[model samples]
Target: MLVKYRGSYEKVAMGLLSFIPDLKDLNNLTNEMTLYQKDESHVLYLWKNKDNDFSGVVGVEVADKYIVVRQISLIPSERGTGNSLEILDELHQLYPDQNMMGSFDTTKLVAKWTEHNRHLNTEV
Candidate 1:
């Protein structure tokens, strides 16, 4: 499940976000987290596995007309297991009323994922 990020989950969120190459720097990652924490329009969601262990972090910016995906990364163990897609699916469910988009940092992956799953003709 996708859960809103909280200060208490700092370590978990950091660990998951670290999987992203661009966020490997602690300073850069923390800055990104701070934006989500302090900015009302930015959101960070931590994904919990069935065992209740945190495994992913998906960030988005709430724009006037859409939710722009800002970042997404899964725990190494969760990669290649379709967990990222599952996370995206849940994000779509949460904001079905608005168009789900991707910012520069996320557009490529989002497009590829959506393209691969276009067979469903549904949000991916």
Candidate 2:
């Protein structure tokens, strides 16, 4: 499930975000988190696993017509297990009105997810 990030999840969010290469640096990680916290258009969501533990983090920038996926990172154990796709699917459902796009970092994964959904819709 997707949970809106809160100050209490700082450590967890940072840890999960660190799994992403660009955010592995402490300074960049801190700044990114700060941006999400301070900017209304930038938002962060934590993925709570079935066991109720946070296993991933997704960051997005909401613009007038698009929700741009900025970052997505899952714990090593959850990688390649469809959790990332699930997170994207949930995000789409959450903001059905706005179009979903990807930032430089997440473009490929977002494209894959979009293609997957497109294929599913055409499978009838």
Candidate 3:
């Protein structure tokens, strides 16, 4: 089971930044998602398991009507179980009404798997 909810970027940013301080910009980056929730300009989704375990997050930024998947991450334990792809799929389904554009980063083996499964470009 997956749950989707509207949340404050401050809370998410605080939690994520504690782990990656360099991601401080994420706090501000998510602002667009917060403000334009219905415009499809940007959106953020946090993923949790059926057991309510926090898994990861995916964020997309829309520019020039292009949906750029800006970030996606899963906790260590959930990495190999296909939860990440499920999250991505959920996001895609959520915004099926839009035309999206983005490339997956394939430098990491896990990224390659995600790209292959999702059928998205992995050069980035």
Candidate 4:
């Protein structure tokens, strides 16, 4: 499940975000996290499975037409576990009335995922 990022989850959020190449710098990671923490327009979520273990992170900017995915990072161990689809699926459910979009790094990922899965009739 995707849970909203909170103060208590700062360390975990930074750890997950560091997996992204662009976010490797501690300063950059801290800055991004601060946006998610204090800005209403920016939102961050942590992916926790049924076992209550966090495996990924998804951050977005709430736009007028859609929610723009600003970043996404999954633990190396959970990279091929189909959790990306799960996280995206839950995000859609959470914002059913809006379009889904993404930032530079996440654009192709989101576009390809939706394109490849659009033909399916069921959720992931």
Candidate 5:
């Protein structure tokens, strides 16, 4: 499940975001969070797994025609478990009318999810 980021989740969000290499630095992480909080176009979400634990974080920039995934990270235990795909799926549900894209860092992850979704739809 995707939980829209709130001020209360700052620590959790930062912790998850730190999993991303580029955001490991405290300064960069703080700036990134500020961008999400200050800019209406950019939004952040926390992923709550089936056990009801927050284990992932995704940041996106919402445009008129598409949502660009800026960053996505999951704890080591959750990596390679298809949870990232699920996070993207929920984002798609939230903005069904818009296409999904990704930033330089997350382009491949978004592409993989898009292809996977396309394959699923074609099979249906």
Candidate 6:
């Protein structure tokens, strides 16, 4: 199941960094989250396993009538199982009227997956 994440989910969110080597530092993640939260510009949701284990997080920033996906990360153990797509679908359903955009490093595997699943342009 997916749930809104509060400050307590910080650790689990930080743990997800292992999947993205360039973002292995918790301090950087914390700083970004803190800034976003303080600015009231971001909302985060987490997907939990049946036992309530943290599986992944989807971060979105609202911009006018659209929602820009800042990041979506799944733990290594949960990769390739369609959990990320499930999360994206839930977010889309929750805000059906809003345009959703997901951004990622163009060189990463995530960029390829996002383009395939969301049908977004690779050049962006």
Give the number of the best model, judged by TM-score.
Answer: 5
lDDT of 5 at 117: 88
Query: Which of candidates 1 and 2 reaches a greater TM-score?
Result: 2
Tell me the RMSD of model 3 versus the true structure.
6.1
The per-residue C-alpha lDDT of model 6 at residue 70 equals: 78
**Prediction 6 global C-alpha lDDT:** 0.70
Model 4: which ten-residue window has the lowest total lDDT?
A: 115-124
**Highest-scoring model, lDDT:** 5
Q: By the lDDT metric, which is better: model 2 or model 5?
A: 5
Q: List the residue pairs that clash in candidate 3.
A: 105-124
lDDT of each structure? 0.86, 0.93, 0.56, 0.87, 0.95, 0.70
2 or 6, greater by lDDT: 2
lDDT of 5 by residue, 7-78 (tens): 999999999999999999999999999999999999999999999999999999999999999999999999
Error of 1 at 91 (Å): 0.4
Lowest-scoring 10 consecutive residues by lDDT in candidate 1? Answer: 115-124
lDDT of 1 by residue, 34-120 (tens): 898899999999999888999889999887778989889887888888787788889888887777788888787778667766867
The lDDT-based order of candidates, best leading, equals 5, 2, 4, 1, 6, 3
TM-score of each predicted structure versus truth: 0.87, 0.96, 0.57, 0.92, 0.97, 0.74
lDDT string, candidate 6, 1-124, tens digits? 6677677877776676435555666667667667656767688777886567888877788777888777777877888887776777788777778877766642253444456765655445
- Candidate 4 lDDT by residue in tens digits, 1-124: 9999999999999999999997899999888988898899999999997688998999988877799888889999888777887888898898877789978888987897688568674654
**Candidate 4 wrong stretches, greater than 4 Å:** 122-124
Q: How much does candidate 5 score in TM-score?
A: 0.97
Question: Local error of candidate 4 at 108, Å?
Answer: 1.4
Q: What would the TM-score be for candidate 6 when compared with the true structure?
A: 0.74
Task: Please list the Cα RMSD from the true structure of every candidate, rounded to 1 decimal place.
Answer: 2.5, 0.9, 6.1, 2.1, 0.7, 5.2
